[model samples]
Target chain A: MNTPNSLLIRRSRRSSNLSFVALGLVAVGLVMMPYVVYQSVTSSMVMLFVLVIIASMWNLLAGFGGLVSIGQQAYIGIGAYTVIVMADLGVHPLIGVFFGALTSAMLALPTSWLAFRLRGDYFAVGTWVIAEVYRLVMIKFQFVGGADGKSLVGLSGLDPVMRSALTYWFALGIAILTVLGCFWLLRSRIGLALTAIRDDEVSARAGGIDATRIKRIVYLVSAAGCGLAGGILVVDALRVQPDAIFSVSWSAYMIFIVIIGGIGYLEGPLIGALVFFAMQQFLAEMGTWYLMLLGVLAICAAAWFPKGLWGAFSQKTGFRLFPVGYHVAQRFDTPVDSRAPLFRN
Target chain B: MQILDALAQGILLGGLYTLFAVGLSIMFGVMRIVNLAHGDFAILAAFLAILLVGETSFPVWLVVAITVPAFAAIGYFLQRTLFQQSLNSGPLSTLLVTFGMSIVIQNALLEAFSANPQRLDVGQLATASFPVGPIAIPYIGVLGLMLAILCIVAIELFLRRTATGRMTRAVSDDPDTARLTGANSRHIYGLATGIAFGAVAIAGLLLAARSSVEPTAGSMRLIFAFEAVVIGGLGSLWGTLVGGLSLGVVQTLVAHFDPSSSILAGHLLFLLVLAFRPQGLIPARSL
Candidate 1:
């Protein structure tokens, strides 16, 4: 006979020794990447970092927050523009990037008030409209070079090699920090609320959670993260253009990466970004064919693998590199013998 | 007189916008699916009309006659084959799949037609205009307005008087109940999409006659269509006309002040509408 007190309150494994080892290995590799790779390769790496950051933030917004926004490019464009304006005003490019992110976050506060008025699919299109408005408004600002755009004048004095190296490191740092921040946030109490909200908003509200408040918080965070990526993007390009930065293709690419990787999982964006970068490297010369292929791939993925690549893979294998949810386990009274285990292996 | 000219032109432009929006409204009202690729399909129809006219030396009217029904068939088949699968998956999946379709259509058009813009030759109608009191309106504009009204009336009659249309309404209201009542909801959805596509096809031909179109043109068309739909409210057919006219007038009025601010003004109005009257000018009850 078992007593009520004998029951165990087991939780999911947060990290394994192997996960730590992998993390250490990745950190070491990234730290040494500039020395090992060419300048061109470093630029590609910076791009990959930006994709990962954008995809991760998108995943956070849509997958967890249940806000399927299609207008995230607004923040990306705004962030880029902010950085450019700051640089033009004689601020250091590095410092400008930070201010750009701040500006985006501040802007998001008001944008959310307008955007949150709509629900579900309406919200998606509303965001896109807002982004278009942002782009159009940016085009009218001739001081920032308007529709023609302008190059960053602030970074002209830095050595080419040193600038590239610094940008790469900054990108790498931002990418890792963004992922880590997401993981930490998801592991907290708020994460549990988000999970509940994602599964069922009405039920989550019924369960005493402030669904609106939490969603607003998530929206703001997502904006800040995307803004950071946007800031980094302008620095890497050393040029800012409304047409280029505000392009819907940015949103499309983010969607592709998040969906391919696994929308709801932390590890999904990382894998998706890598896969996308690899595909772009090989198939980019195919031009329209590459884009068409991406579209086909997304359609197929949506139909068959709604859980995404990593999502399906994790479900089958029962493996999680960054576990944020609880896993139940059995507890035994006696210490584990050689023949028997206390928890399922 | 100047303001009157802008208003008259805006009203005529509104007719074109109504054409763009009505199809979107019907699809949303009946299917509860926002076809992200709606504008791309319109662009595709325009290109198809251009190709048909170019290859066969058919008149623009003849080309429209050929393409509209063909578009309906394409829409029917697409809903049956591709969109049907995603319908039950949830709105997010439908959105993603349709977005993917948009990308595919846009890229395919780019590949097939290159980046060059193409315009349909309307002969004398392109430049011809007649004075109405103090305002001058182009012949094409009047034709576009008349066609828009005709299409809207036809679609309204079809929905109200037809059995299939009622079934579509039923399916949209409650799919399971409609299914229980022996209505093939899937088939009804297909028909609804087909009708919507037919409207889009005509709009596409009209659009080509009005201006040049390229592969990427669909996106702006989509934004305009979406704005009209939102401004009109979700399920009101007549409100779409009002919405479209409002959008057109706002753009023209803004352009009057500064030509560069034309598109921006429309977008700003959309945002204002969204903020103040999210239910739109004429709100509809639940579908």
Candidate 2:
């Protein structure tokens, strides 16, 4: 009995509810991973979490905000460096992680002013140049270890197993926070403005969206998130080398993950990270050949499947694990059936 | 004397950079696509030249002559197929495709020719240089500067005078109108890319002659070329020379004072130009 008089608008569907349960299960399993898996396995999982955080942040910036930055490793280096420096100053490395995020966000405010001068593709190269600037500047600062870089000083006393577990937990928590934060941000008014800006900047501005302000906010968030990931990376590696930390390869990984999994979708990074991690593990023996293959696959995905693997899958099934869009359902004036129709055409 | 020497060397370095940038400018001007693989393609040419020199009995000049034309053909085919399709999809697709190509080319080169840096054996030319006052100018550097000027002049003339060049300009200005009026935009685009590729191959040969090149050397070259283009102003051929020269002078001067800061100084100059004068030192009237 369809009520012609009234229509109900909502976001979640039956599939979303099922997805919630599945996600909750996955979360619990991830939290319990260290207990069940070997130490080496948990150590590798730490990298997976870092990838998730960085990829999600990148998606927020490029996919949603239309800022295709190719130099995000600047913040990654800053974050790692901040953590190392903080530890050198006698502050705990764990506490320094937050400082990493804070420092990156603070630096991003100034960087946006310079980077925003160039539009579209030029913006991409501008950011890369800025990142190069950051790397060169870092190399000059001998107090912060200069080109030689510094080690994670404060973590010398912690037990190896305990430290790894703690690192894993921190990574997991941050990855989850990044994803949920992005989900909530998208569901808010700012997210709507970002979607509009992404589709067409001129129209979005014409429609009263403060495109610059929103884009700035997204850029800051992305910088902070990448910074946090960098902090985690240094803790895992136990040393911070300027060249290794600030390498553009980090940007390449983020771009490849976003393009392969799904560009705009929230779930895309998660799925892409799993696939990337698997590939990294299996193709470890292949040296740089596997990277070439990854590059080829990314090109194919961009050319043929522009929507990416997750995007194509969702388009076919009309099922969203993270239903970020609204749908309308018809309701009668009288009491309707308790079971809401799943397919609300 | 040191400063004078640096300036002379810097001018020569700028010539090399101008060569790299001209190809990039052509691609961007015609297609509104920044070829991220521009540097990688240049590197590939250098590597190929090295291989040819090692394996074949041909002279270096003969190898360069063969490779330049060969790369032009390759460029035309790539544009007709890979780049054209990516362009049809949109700007993001083009960026991703080119970026992916950069990584693929880099890794493939690494696989084929180890990580060791290799240089083109220009024999006695590498060591020969003449002194002017307190400054020394290498014969190879002068050759590169002459080549750079020659390529830019040739391209400028081609785009300005040739009928096909007019077709390219028309397509760039209004693709839809050009298509309606009987010009095949695709073919014109291919021609532009072919010219760019040929120019970049020359840059590669020069780079190899000047210094050693490795698989990983392409990214910095891309940055240098990109900086030159932006500082010179997009779509302006002569402006690229101005931009490249300024960048080279700044880097060399900085290196004279503090060795580690040479590249940083060049990058800083570029950023300053970008911040203060985004239009470039001498913006073209219309490319």
Candidate 3:
């Protein structure tokens, strides 16, 4: 028996070369999307961008932060209302989107204080109640057309083509930034802390992690992302309504996308958003049936494939575009010795 | 006089709310799973009652009597199948599955019944009011209150005295130990859900008698029931009634001052309670 002469220290592979190539191609395609796609297609892409952003943020919250909120529609509604109100005050709709996000983040601070009181399922319902309160209160603001809602006032001056293009670009930029921001956050020290907390809260706390502070930050960030998406949605629609914007269906859509694409994976939202968009394009005309199908699909997914489409695919292929977990690789140079045991179990 | 009337009306309103929440309270207490489709199930019961009355020439009361047992069967079947599978997965999976169920039920109802609001006419009972000193309360309101009280008492007694109910309590207390003691936890869960559905069916009839119901109405009802459950405490049956009454009174009082803020007032109170006393006003002793 020969003793091992060489030792290798293993480190997890972060990304494949193929992943970088794919990312490059996707970035270029997005940049030239306005020229490559028709106006109608561009408009639909706007919807896709907004959906992806919202779904990704939701994934981060529930997938990473261990906070499953069904009330993100509150921030969406608030953000839309903020843009509409700002437009009323003679501000450019473009500039108001940031303010909308800022306002949402501010509101999230107080909301987290209240929402964090409850644990698990209670938190889900509590967030929903907060959203309902926001909707009801918005109906009383007679200046913003109250229950009827209002249209964004100042966008009529811009050319239709220019406005659409700009909105599309803004959405694209926001979607890219949200994905990168989440990826960056997850790779940071806080991300490791979050992963620990997600797996076992008691143990994480016992390990000296401040679960409350991390959760608060994640909640605030999610609100800001949803807020920006909401702003973009109103801008694309050119109208805002309390009933429509504050509808829980928005949250449902986000959940569906996240669940279908891959709940915890980084690329899951993009894939989920595209699948949803395709379905919506084809079946939206069927009206209630389309919604029923979505419901059925969501239920089936939760029951049969809780890990989602990407999750199952990754398990089989060992492929990850945005790999966060570590993977060990064995060096081929070390000769196997059956009696000495080739590798540590 | 106005304030007194408002308070009386609010308390009466709370009776219906208690009926809505008792089912939720039971399901939560026994299984620790908050059924997101609970409001949709109640609305489904209402629609079923309406269909029965419309198709057969059965009277409203008979329709309710038939529907209650039918809903119980549905509760049992759903628990044994879909809910049981999801429960094994985890609490979050159960939540998502129920949420999906809610969506499916709402859309199916919309497709079958259309979006038109439907009401169950109970002839003279709906409009008839009796004088309680200076206040006049509708007969339906009194009936709802009496029915709610009867249901709560019956459930309490059942849980305390009956063999199956004791089994349920045992399971709720400790599922693993209950299993070790030879109790079938799944069957117990199904029974609890069945009872909960029966209660919801009765509540649905009361709701239809009081006002119009549509497919979308389930969402609001869900919020109200959730609020009442949270306010009352997680596993406490009697506390649910008190929570419902408090919510009703608060809404009515706000309505008396400003009608538009009535719903908002209840939600605000719920939030305040959540923020200040996360354990709830009358927390369960087991917790």
Q: What are the TM values for chain B, all candidates? A: 0.96, 0.98, 0.97
Write candidate 3's Cα lDDT for A1-25 as tens digits.
Answer: 2235233223234355578578879
- Whole-model lDDT per candidate: 0.86, 0.90, 0.87
Q: Per-residue lDDT of A1-345 in model 1, one digit per residue for the tens?
A: 354334343445544447857887998899799999899999889999999999999999999998988899999988888888888789998888778778888998999999998777778888898888888888888898989998887898899999999999999999999999999989888898999999998999999999989988888888888888889999998998888899999999999999899989988998999999999999999999999999999988876678898998898987788768756555557433444432332
Backbone clashes, each candidate: 0, 2, 0
- Listing candidates in order, what is each one's chain A TM-score? 0.93, 0.94, 0.91
Worst 10 residues of 2 chain B by lDDT: B278-287
Q: Candidate 3 residues B27-66, lDDT tens each? A: 8888887888889999999998888888889998788879
| CA error at residue B205 for candidate 1, angstroms | 0.9
lDDT for position A102 in model 2: 95
Report the lDDT tens digits of candidate 1 across residue range B1-287: 78888988888898888888888888888777788898999999999888877888788778878899999999899888788888766657878898899999999999999989998777888888998897788998888778778878987787778887777778889989999999998898898889889988888888888899998888888889889988877788777888888999999977877888899889888888888898888887643
After TM-score superposition, what is the CA distance of residue B54 in candidate 2 from its true location, in Å? 0.9
Rank candidates, TM-score, best first: 2, 1, 3
Could you give me the TM-score of model 3 versus the true structure?
0.95
- Per-residue CA lDDT of candidate 2, range B1-287, in tens? 77788899999989899999999988888888888889999999999999999999999889999999999999999999988888887668888888899999999999999999999998999879998877789999898888888988998898889998888889988899999999999999999999999999989988998899999898898899999988998779999988888888888889989998999999999889877898889875567
When candidate 2 is compared with the true two-chain complex, its DockQ is: 0.76
Q: Highest lDDT among the candidates is held by which one?
A: 2
Best by DockQ: 3
